[model samples]
Target chain A: EPEVTQTPSHQVTQMGQEVILRCVPISNHLYFYWYRQILGQKVEFLVSFYNNEISEKSEIFDDQFSVERPDGSNFTLKIRSTKLEDSAMYFCASRGGRYNEQFFGPGTRLTVL
Target chain B: TQLLEQSPQFLSIQEGENLTVYCNSSSVFSSLQWYRQEPGEGPVLLVTVVTGGEVKKLKRLTFQFGDARKDSSLHITAAQPGDTGLYLCAEARRGGATNKLIFGTGTLLAVQP
Candidate 1:
């Protein structure tokens, strides 16, 4: 089965540095999403993209966060400045066809020092 | 903001035991989905329930949506060690470029061999 894939399985960055988390959703899927899970907390929605634009975003997805489909296959989330609270497991997901299920990638663990 | 709450935040049981995880919300859901996530990996979709009072079974795991569409449950019969993971329930918000998933607080299960 084809699955979403993310790069840099683990990322460590300075508190004020920028980091980009990359994902390649399923080859034919049209919708993409980003979610984060703080250690010991619920997975929280960050943003959703479709038609090459952001569809929705949460409060956590403030000015510091931006998403782009820079190429046909790559969906990337960029954090302008990292913070200790931004450390979490970030997952990328995609949905296609008529199903409600969204397939997820293995996730990128972001650690800000 | 709506929140999905899952009960029994942690469960530790021997293999072959039965278990049930509950996801509840004060708000009604358009649809409910269940996912299992292993550490360092993204959540894998298990089941999706759309209608009120719907029941769907996938092998030894059974999922049911509440009659009011405000809750759902996952019941595992004869669970194996492979079933150990963080189980999450999520609902797709209605209006977005692409509906984004709002996940529930997860239930972490540890099935011992």
Candidate 2:
């Protein structure tokens, strides 16, 4: 079955550096989303995108965070300047037009030191 | 904000045992989903329940949505060591153009052989 895939399974960056987490959702899925989970914490919604625009975002999705669909298949989340608290597992998900079931990618582990 | 609370944050059981994980919330949900995740991997979709009081079974796993749509439960029968992982319950984004999933804190299960 087709699945969502992410690049750079793991990343390490300095506290003030930038990082970009990339994901390629299922080929035909229309809606895309980004979520994060701190160690021993619940997964929190970051943002959602459709029609190449951000549909909604949570409070945690502040100015430092941005998402882009650079091409048909690639969706990316960029943190301009990482913070120690930004260390977590970032996941990307997508859902097709049919049902509400959203498929998730393997996730990108972001480590900020 | 929607908050989903999962009961029994951690569970350890022997092989061939049965267990149930509960997800509860004060806010009613339009749909709920169950996912399983390994240590370093993204969540894998197990099932989605839409209607209130709906029940769906996947092999040895049984999923039920509460009649009020504010709770759900996942029951695993004859669980094996392979069932060890983090189980998450999520509610779909309500009244929005996007379908972001609001996830619970998650339950970590370790099935010993």
Which of the numbered candidates is closest to the native, going by highest DockQ? Answer: 1
**DockQ scores of the candidates:** 0.85, 0.81
Q: Give the clashing pairs for model 2.
A: none
Off by more than 4 A, model 1: none
For model 2, the superposed segments whose C-alpha errors exceed 4 Å read none
Model 1: how far residue B9 lies from native, Å: 1.6
Candidate 2 lDDT score at position B13: 99
Tens digit of lDDT per residue, candidate 2, span A35-106? Answer: 998988888889999999999999999999999999999999999999999999999999874556889999
lDDT of each: 0.92, 0.92
Interface RMSD of 1: 1.0
Give the proportion of true interface contacts each model preserves, from 0 to 1.
0.93, 0.89
Q: What lDDT would candidate 1 get against the real structure?
A: 0.92
Docking class of 1: high
TM-score of 1: 0.95
- For candidate 2, give the lDDT of residue B29: 87
